[model samples]
Target: MKVIFIRHSEPDYSMLDKAQNPQAYVEFGRDLAPLTARGRLLAQEAAQNPLLDEAEVIISSSITRALETAFYMARHRAINLLVEPFFHEWRPDLDGLNYTEVELALAHQTYMVNDGNLPSDSPIRYETGAEVKARFLLALKKYCQYETVAVVTHGMLMRQFVPLDHIDYCQFVTCDIDL
Candidate 1:
């Protein structure tokens, strides 16, 4: 069985700068938005990948960006697209203080390096690494039964769910193991 984890393309965060108050920024982070123009183009390019074109089944996070990406691929290849909420982006709330670009970047680094775990001081609901890992591993097991499946999701979820044996972010990757 082969499962492909695809990160959603770029997101437009221009409005993030307008967040004059702390509450607004937190709300902005929580709000789900669609992809930018570049994101759509990137997704289109991703669909063109030979490996993706060969996928027998397509799955995606319920978020609009993932759904949009999945739809683009589904249009090219006749396949039913499945929506998996578990694959949604890891949305952790920041402290009431608005985020500095540096802080936001560091937060992403911590989540990736720490397996989606973050410090207690962080304002996020703070889902544990074990929780994210458990759900992701379970999703992988459930999805990998098929011979070939493509999963479109956010970068954080991709990092969590992608098998460690093969980690390549440059483009689509294939792995033989279920891990």
Candidate 2:
């Protein structure tokens, strides 16, 4: 099987600075953030890549940004887009607490140090990196029947499953799956 992973397009983060409560801002942004105009064009351009033309199925995280990117690929290929919550981004904090970008980076570092072992007193309720990998692998197994599958997801999630040095917005990489 072949699995092509596509990162969602650029999100508009300008509104994040204006919110009074950072946690609320993040929660709302997670659900509502849309792509910038350039992001839309990027997605459209990405859809034209020859690799996607062979996609037999397209799946995407339910997040709006991912869905938007998936829409372009699905429309270009004339395939129905399947929504999968399991493909959502990794959440380090379960309480919907506000975490700045710097803090999130630190948390990832901590998680790596712990080998994805959640500390007993961890403030954020999120799947560890190991857990994310396990779930993503399981989801791929369930979809293994497809000859070519395009999965639209977030950068963090893709990193957990594959060795991606960097993933630009609307960028995609194809990997061969033994299954």
Candidate 3:
């Protein structure tokens, strides 16, 4: 099986500043962030890339940005887009507490540095990197029957499964799997 993982396009963070509550902004932004104009163009360009020409199925995270990114390719290929919540980014704070970007960054860094063994005292309830990898692998197994598949997901989740220092918006990594 051939699986291509595409990260969501650039997000528009302008609305975040206008939010009255930073915590609410962070919570809402996770699912509400839309693509910037350039992001849309990038997605359009990605749709025409030869790499996706052979894709027989398109699956995307339930997040708005990912859905928007996948729309271009799905429409171009005339395939129905499948929405999967399992592909969504890891949520560190289930309590919906307001967390600054700096805090979030530090937490992510710690998570990576510790190999996903978060400190027991940590207040945030999040899936460890290893957990994300396990779930992603499971998702792949579920879709192994397809000859060619395109998955649109978050960069954080992708990093757990693919070796990469960074994943640019709309960028994709392809892997051939033996089912």
Question: Which candidate tops TM-score?
Answer: 3
> Number of the top candidate by lDDT?
3
- Per-residue accuracy of model 2 over 49-84 as CA lDDT, tens digit each: 888877898999988899999998899889978998
With candidate 2 superimposed using the best TM-score fit, by how many Å does residue 135's alpha carbon deviate from the native? Answer: 1.3
Candidate lDDT scores, in order, read 0.66, 0.80, 0.81
For candidate 1, what is the lDDT? 0.66
Q: Is candidate 2 or candidate 3 better by lDDT?
A: 3
Q: Sort by lDDT, best first: what order?
A: 3, 2, 1
Choose 1 or 3, whichever is better by TM-score: 3
Every model's Cα RMSD, please?
4.4, 2.8, 2.2
Q: Which of 1 and 2 is ahead in TM-score? A: 2
Better model by lDDT, 1 or 3?
A: 3
TM-score of each: 0.71, 0.82, 0.87
lDDT tens digits, residues 127-174, model 3?
688888777777777776689989999888888767897899989898
**Which sequence of candidate numbers ranks them by TM-score, best first?**
3, 2, 1
